[model samples]
Target: MAETAKPAPAPEASAGPVSAAGAYLAAGVASSEADYAAAVEWYGRALSGDPANPALLQGALMAHVGTGDMVGAAKLAQAFQAAGGKSQIATVVLIAGDAKRQDYAAILKEQAAGGSAGAVLDDLVKAWAKLGLGRMSEATEAFDKMAKTKGLEAFGLYHKALALASAGDYEGAENILSGKAGGSFPLTRRGLIATVEILSQLERNPEAVALIDRNFQPGTDLEIDDLRRRLDAGEPLPFTIVRNAGDGIGEVFYSMANAVKGDADASFTLLHARAAAYLRPDNTEAILLVAGLLEQQRQHVLATAAYATVSPSDPNFHAAEIGRANATFAAGHPEAALEILQALARTHGDILAVQLALADGMRREKRYDEAFKAYDAAIKMVPNPGPGHWVLFYSRGVVSDALRHYDAAEADFRRAMALNPNQPELLNYLGYSLVDQGRKLDEALGLIKRAVLMQPDSGAILDSLGWAYYRLERYRDAVLPMEQASQRMPVDATVTDHLGDVYWAVGRKREAEYQWRRALSYDPDEKLAARLRLKLAKGLDAVLAAEGAAPLKPVAAAAAQP
Candidate 1:
């Protein structure tokens, strides 16, 4: 059976009326749960009403394209063109389909007509078509022409190096990286990795190691670690970067495509990113970008495959791993995600972020003790933990409490509070703990009151305040706060139970019983469940007698002289 998809926020409602056009627009903005079927329906409706509307035609074409209904996309594109509408999107779709169909001559003809698809793209496609037609010298000349263009030199140079390497010219690729060429591009991790591979292929292991060490140090990520190992082992790596003008233009489009992904048309974004990856098979970043776009469209399996393309030796491997883990978890395979994280942790032990990933994975698996150890490791790895690090302490506190190590849990909470004194969660958690222990009631109440002041709308903090009041026997005062807490956390079992207890303390028996039933339905804890059972079996009086707690009294009446 297929795994269920994770919940995502509902899509923003479409603007305007509920007409066919409006429905189509709404479908465009709908969550992935609505599926392409919904999009097709809406598009059909819009097209039926306004068959020649360019926007509606484009929308329908895209819906079909997304669903891999190529026949439909082609038919719509033909119809759209016959209606005197020149859609850049439709043209690109047609070009891509043509390429897949090996209609190279037609693709070249379209390119010759100056298809205003992409400036850099048109030139690159023309160059590749030349290469495809067995014109090597023309391809080389075309690549050189692109290399001379302003602001496009680096891209051209990189592709030139790849082309040289692919043609068994390792020395040429190395010369480019070594600045034997007139110009130089800043060596990003990807560029450096490719350079190192070229050097290694040329049997220059020392040069490769120098490049790796200079660009990627020991303390960063698993990919660097793996590269370091390969260098140490003196392994000969293969050169894999763009080798032609087509690939260079693809990189340019891919880079800009990533930045504009969610803000622009998905089909267009996918086109640019896919074109980049197609032109440069080893462009991991482009692949990842394509995967991200696919993820946004809810194509989980395809996204996962794209993410997996980032090899262990790529600098972006960690990023890919994270994406893969998230996809796996979203696809309802938490165990698979944990496995991936554990493997990453083993290889990337020195990186704090990797350890944090491990801790998150373990926590999701409910292995609290192991997760605590991972968190501890992560905390120790950081020289001076930031305010964000406080969450680690707070999370560990939860794990500690779950493990019945309340004293340790309190210490972690206090540490987190020290780091972020005004953090309402920490304040409420620690304050609630003290109240539950039935010790330091006054101090707990003060802390909880402060927490409530800090987060007036937080149901948990408000519940803590009410519970503290109930513990202090300020029963009448507890009623208002408890009711407010119940309003905020209407579905929370513990808060509902607390509200019921406060109601009973204030002599509202029927209301208290009603709340108790509500609490039970919400699945309260064993202790709360027992209290609710007792209240049903006997009364609040019997529960108080059994627990050996003092009778309700006003705060002033219960106070003692210091």
Candidate 2:
């Protein structure tokens, strides 16, 4: 899910030279807001006034890198180092610059001189540098050393397999990737793709197909499906996971970014992802990773720019466009975002993910008719609908309900339940709808109880369960769950209103009126608001009598029933 952009933190005014202080403060504010273009501008101004300031140099370098200007960042890095400054980011940028130039010796010299870019990254870069220098034995030895280190075995083994495949030692790479040479380790999407390519080189297309099938499902992942289709056609895939030493170094940075993503600061991960893209601009995976991290940080404009860099011909182009739509939406341009998805749906309509994304966007925008059509197109693309396709049915059901096609909505919801019987959201939605219509009271209560069992902490599900009991006239049974639901969702207008209704049925008239006031303060729909006001003025019984509805049974009377 894309985060809505938040206000940028205010930068403290620096107590420095007056001109430099203003520039520094402006740059800091821009950077905090992820306005890298403005940050680069302000930091450049700050650097011009304070040429030798280490902090200014570092900030400028980061801003340039964030904009994907590796050439500019390299120049600032050199100036930073010339000023007696030391930084891990500088080391990473310099190493990437050297790799781009194919100057492996410089990278080795930097490492030998104790230029560190994190322990794991430095070690991986050293191994790749050795490979670039044609010192195969040293490279293998360095990779072995990394594998022997605790907590880094997976990365080391995975890269060693890639290096072996790049060197045309397919059998050796297969041994490592197949877990015959080393213990089992998880493979990332890139790692798995590399393995499939290696298998194809060895004329093991069947095994590659099986590998793809085992890891991915049909109509789910377009990239995986494309690879599988080509492999099944007996196409010989060339090993290109790492085309050269530069790509190997890029992979090292990309791997580190993947490793530290959720554990490290977003900016820290961005540094690694940027370095990866700088080293290998053709690496769509790295570009997507950079865009995703920026989106996570609510830098929607920057993320959209990053996503735009993925070429349309790339297999992951659909994925990039989806991400771009999300960033665009989060940037507060819903119309533009919807257009992007609409265009993607036209071009890649056969791809399941694209259609689903378009449908979801339509649903979010409350275009129920268009959403229903998009969902139908997506569902038709599935070869045989299975349990994993429950979301498609459920989403279409939601649109159906919104469009007042209750029969179609019920059918779709039942279809979703048949596909995924225990899905709590589907259960709660269907059960609550049944209760609201005063139909299937017993079955509605049972379905809601099941949903509550699965998601005890979900305020919506609890509300549904309580509402089911209240509709069945079990007022006392409804009280505890409704109160619990209100507590869980303290400010939800509907839950508070339901709690008020339950309280009134149980003869807690004063508390009932208080809860109705709270619900009104929470801003319910106009229809519910008018009803709540009537109940407040004339009391629950008077309002029910005016509407010719059955009055709430007393708690004692409800409990006295069988």
Candidate 3:
């Protein structure tokens, strides 16, 4: 499910320039949503002018299959074939169609002739075909054959065992776990759970309990909880561990892939996960692992497809949707992501984590009202709110401030501060808000100073401190800190403008003009930009009059000395 790049649209010959751009834009949007029909229509419009464009051809192939238009896909494949346009995607689609038709022999013949299929997939599909033919012995042998491939033997051995157990050869499966099998597949939590079940099926309840305790003594999940209950009840559990060797290796790769974070090479990790998933079609863990890696690499579209494989019935469905939503947001499709989260909120109403996630997504998109509602719902749902609830209040406070709901914003900030006393961000934000409103100058200065002491390296906190001084009419005293703040946040127009004001108040007229110019170059808000322009045109006194703020006062001689 690694996200593929969206193919560029073909140049439109039939349509006017603006219409062509519109078609291209529409295709881009459709592809992002996986609305293949709409994407096809848009691409077709573009292709009317550039029929021979390879990018359009590639997009058409993807759109056709994504929409389940197999006939259309086949036609595209035929066209590509005639045009000598070879691609892995085209080949895979053809193989997939053959797979649907149960034409295994033909697939095998083609694979042998082509000699270019994904190695793991080639083995797995062949083994599955052997299963379809009711040739259990051959299927088992096929798995063994796959096991012989370098770096893939564990997968083969694992799937072979699952195939054995699934075929009702429980004793044989247990024997494989007992080390009768030549290869060793690394056991995972899931694998161990399956192994315990297999042991129970062999009437080895004691061994099953022992295995569960040995592997999962310190943690619990739904699977482990169920196993514990069965063990207590002395029930014979089924051997549900993968009997297929390919699946075992898939599990191994999937586990490794998930653990690959924070400095691991994403491409290498993806290769393992992809190989494992290819070897085992039903390996949701592997698919998710691939998606997670792709997301870490900022490959959003690929991550989305990988996450899409987790069906609603899967235990990890919520996790997958969360990943999918994050990828969609990362891909700059905030609306689609919000829609997904809204749907999830309805279905997973009782899940506090899901509600929080939805709220967080809304906050990221600056939908303050919607985010506040979600946060309220989350707060109500948590019967005994924990320390983590501070984040909700803090986030809500930010959104409230953005909406100019000062009273509510202050209340939320105070609430968060009470829960997590001396929190740097809360202090800085609340203090900055006060400073911006030109209210409670002394208290705001004190709060910002405290925040600065806690996080001196923070440019935002330093800016607040500088602005507070400027508000207090201590222009000379504001100069150094404001300059430091500007250096730390050199690109921030507000910081630069604050520095300019401090300069003008100290009678450094030329320096003030230079800073004002720099502030304009920083591209601040329209109001700030206008103020800076006025300051450059006349002086800080004129700008202050325009802003209705008190005029700058000269500092005492002792302060001016600095």
Candidate 4:
């Protein structure tokens, strides 16, 4: 991604002030392209010329933070603030650095002076910092103040529970999580873990068991199953979610990061994630969250680097590897993804998540036989898999069909539908395949109708239903859905071609010619193009005769014969 040297700046530019704006523009381009290192370098070049440029200074800070350089980010933040930049990024970076050294007074000072860090985050961090400073009453007040924020009942109450637990007040933590104190809130996975630890601390195993049973579906998640067994056996679950005040503060940032995920751009969220990582280097959950945000922004290299920090011994290591491999694959490095999966398959063979990711990557890379084997291995790990596993069968079915194992593919597709009868994708794939083979026309039409009802807005599913009707010689019925699918998926050659055939069947010769020409413009595969060309010149009946196929039979003709 390195750029070659360009021509020098204008003599007027050299005689006047340096073009920091131009350097910032280049940095922005690199950051958007996922080249954080290049962005950092360019932003630094900008800063050297215009040291007080708030926009350029914060831009460099973000690049440094995005690359996980807390030290460098802190230094840049100091320079930015001294230059009167008024940066929330700088405030958060400085606050994180202070928190890392356990300097609670710095956090309080920043808050007392009216924070440059975001208002919500400033208050939350202050509460956790108070806990670290051994001022329990003040910490409680800050948490209560946060709880009073409109529509933030869950976040505030959740943090207050963590504050209690970290101080060995497990009974108080239990009150909040169990809804006996602080109004009700939906328990997230991390919240559930905290509650489990709290209940175990109070030796209330039965309540913890009930909580697990209420939250998770029967035989759904392995983590839930293990937690249930340990609680049943009267084993105490450790409070690992927030082990200290520092970790609690990190959790505060992580919670806000999740809350703002959809509403904010990636750069803003990346700042909070970076702070969390700084406080707890061993926080695998936080680390993975950071990597995921980077991936969303297309910063795949930085994401992969972040993912690599989770060691093999960590419980979240497989999850990290899966994410890293996906990032590597997405960065036009499929071989890297394949290499990691191959190693992981040998090392973590029993883990279904790892196996599934490996299988999916192989399937994407067109290693069909290897994908089938990996998918089967992943399936076997689950005895009597449930509706959640329809994806495994569905994916395997696709590879099976591609490999021309049609019978096996059909069986897989049927099993997937049986497992999840309402899944529109399963309905569409199976129905479309049957229709394409010119068999079970009635059943195919019914399945496709059900699928269309479930996912009326899905262009692919709509196309499948339309194709089913067309193959049934229900030309009139096909037209509406075919046209709708074409409208939604305008660039799809298959949908365009299908519409052309439906038009031809209805005797709209000019419209049929128009659609075929349109499909050709969109670039159908060579074989489909050749067939389309024959139809354009000789008509459907003549083309069928040349290919040793019977002429199309409309539904009425078949019904009359019966």
Report clashes for each candidate as comma-separated counts: 1, 0, 25, 0
RMSD of each: 8.1, 3.6, 7.6, 4.9
Q: CA lDDT, every prediction? A: 0.73, 0.89, 0.72, 0.83
TM-score of each: 0.62, 0.89, 0.62, 0.86
lDDT per residue (tens digit) for residues 343-373 in model 3: 9888876666688889899889888898888
- Cα lDDT of model 1 by residue, 143-180, tens digit: 67887999877656765666667667889777876778
Model 1 local distance difference test score = 0.73
Q: Could you give me the TM-score of model 3 versus the true structure?
A: 0.62
The residue-by-residue lDDT of candidate 2 on 465-526, one tens digit each, is 88998999888889999989998999899999999999999899999999999999987989
Please write out the lDDT profile of model 4 over residues 151-247, one tens digit for every residue: 8778788999999898899998888888898778888777887898788888988999998888887444656677889999999888878887888
Q: Judged by lDDT, which candidate is best? A: 2
Sort by lDDT, best first. 2, 4, 1, 3
Q: Which residue pairs collide in model 1, if any?
A: 163-243
Which candidate has the top score in TM-score?
2
Q: Which residue segments of model 1 deviate by more than 4 Å?
A: 1-243, 261-306, 383-388, 419-422, 439-456, 475-488, 523-541, 548-562
lDDT of 3: 0.72
